[model samples]
Target chain A: MSNTPNRNRQLRSKLGRVRGLGSSHEGVHHWWAQRMSAMALLPLSLWFIFSLISLTGSDYVAFQSWVSEFGNSVFLVLFLVSMFHHAQLGLQVVIEDYVHSELWKMGLLLIVKYGSVLFAASGIFAVLKISLAG
Target chain B: MAEDDRPLSPHLQVYRPQITSVLSITHRATGVFLSLAAVMLTYWLASAAYGPDSFARAQAALESWFGRLILFGFTFSLFFHMCNGIRHLGWDLGWGFDLVKLRMTGVLVIISAFGLTVLSWVMAYSHVGKL
Candidate 1:
């Protein structure tokens, strides 16, 4: 009748009478997002590097023109999204690995994940506004 | 052989440190560095979008001595993390697991990271007139 024991019961291993219930749906969601964001980061990262190099000495007008380009803005948006999401995933793992206190770790993870999303969305909107307005 | 049935063998305390260990530690350190760096990326994008004054501030920071040092550290961390991640990807693909190969690859990643970092700085400096 105790929920605590029943919760443990759901996670039993195959060698035991039951396998411990594997990751919940939320766990799978985070894992999938991490992998997918990493995949997105791969090419976006390369593009970002090249873009930085290309824009090295360009003035404000030049940079404005660059961002105003349809393709440039599109890729830049992708890069921004992937960068923040990947950062969230990486930071979550680091926190989980090193943060010994469960409450602190959970709080930090939530702050990091939500903070990253908010920052990424704000950044993306700024970019779209600039690119579209121009 | 039954000992293999145990989940994980020989815990952390049993291991001694070495050059490879140092490099391994740096890989994770740089990873955290780059993760934080990604937040800076958001700032850069936002600043760029905010127009000239904001953008100039971002550029000014990057051009400052302290900023240059941080940028250099970031560049090194980026390359180190990338090389080490590729090594990991190789392992994930079931390649490069032999002892000799592992050591060689570890050294190779460190070397490549340094080489790429220096090369990037050289290119960046060579183009300093543009900034």
Candidate 2:
């Protein structure tokens, strides 16, 4: 996002493909999602830290009951979704940075994107299943 | 996409390691690590939702030395990421751009990470030895 030459080059992309990716592919969406998630996590993560602190000595029944609470379940769902979304974006940037092989890079990026979604879904499902049962 | 060999930007070999550089790079590494750790988080949640038996099994695994080590790493990484995340937000808000402030904040993040990790463990140990 900081590359002036890259932005200028991409700015020409709105006119049509001059070199490679267009302005449409400027990656602001990805950046915005990451930023938003970071903002969201600011409070959510604090809540999470306090919740875990409260659960520090809790037993299984305590944890089960705590998680079964409607508010806790809903907050957890939000946390998982935003956390995974932010994580996927971060990993995409990482793979793009270190993995020089274009094919491998693309493969890994796809895996990260899909994998985060799958895992986050599983996490949310777990939260819901427990909350519903209790 | 670049096929031609240009002079290229300076590589890691060109510069001495500093707290700023180290923390900057480790932030990415820890970010990637946390993403992978997210899988384990899912597993734990799934087990918890399953039943007492499954939760017990998961708890046993997490209580193991290997799992504890991993958890420690995860905890440390979380704190580091959190502190550095604040620093990033500062950058986004157009503050702390100066070299001195950057380096100071970098060191503070490192210290905060260790402090948080230690404090967490202490709290856990005082409460439940599970951590």
Which model scores highest in lDDT? 2
What would the per-residue lDDT of candidate 1 be over residues B1-131, giving only the tens digit for each residue? 56325454234456897656767778778978986677777787688788889999998997799988887898888888878877876776799888888899999998999998887777765676632
State the lDDT of candidate 2 residue by residue for B29-111, as single tens digits: 89888886778878989999989899989888988999889988988888899899999989989999999999999989999
In candidate 1, which residue pairs get closer than 3 Å at backbone N, Cα or C atoms, i.e. clash? A10-A21, A11-A20, A11-A21, A12-A18, A12-A19, A12-A20, A13-A19, A13-A20
Q: RMSD of each candidate?
A: 7.1, 5.2
Each model's lDDT: 0.77, 0.84
True contacts kept of 2: 0.67
What is the alpha-carbon lDDT of model 2 when measured against the actual structure?
Answer: 0.84
Deviating ranges (above 4 Å) for candidate 2: A1-24, B1-10, B129-131
- Candidate 2: tens digits of C-alpha lDDT, residues A1-134: 57466545533544455334446566356767888999998788768766876787566788889999988998899989988998998998878667777799899999998899899999999999988888
lDDT of 1 by residue, A1-134 (tens): 46565545634445443432344424355666766776677677767766776677787778878888999889988877887877888788778766766689899999998988988897788778778867
Please give the TM-score for the first chain of candidate 2.
0.82
| Candidate whose DockQ is highest | 2
Prediction 2 TM-score vs. true: 0.86
On a 0 to 1 DockQ scale, where is model 1? 0.40
Q: Cα miss at B116, model 1 (Å)? A: 1.5
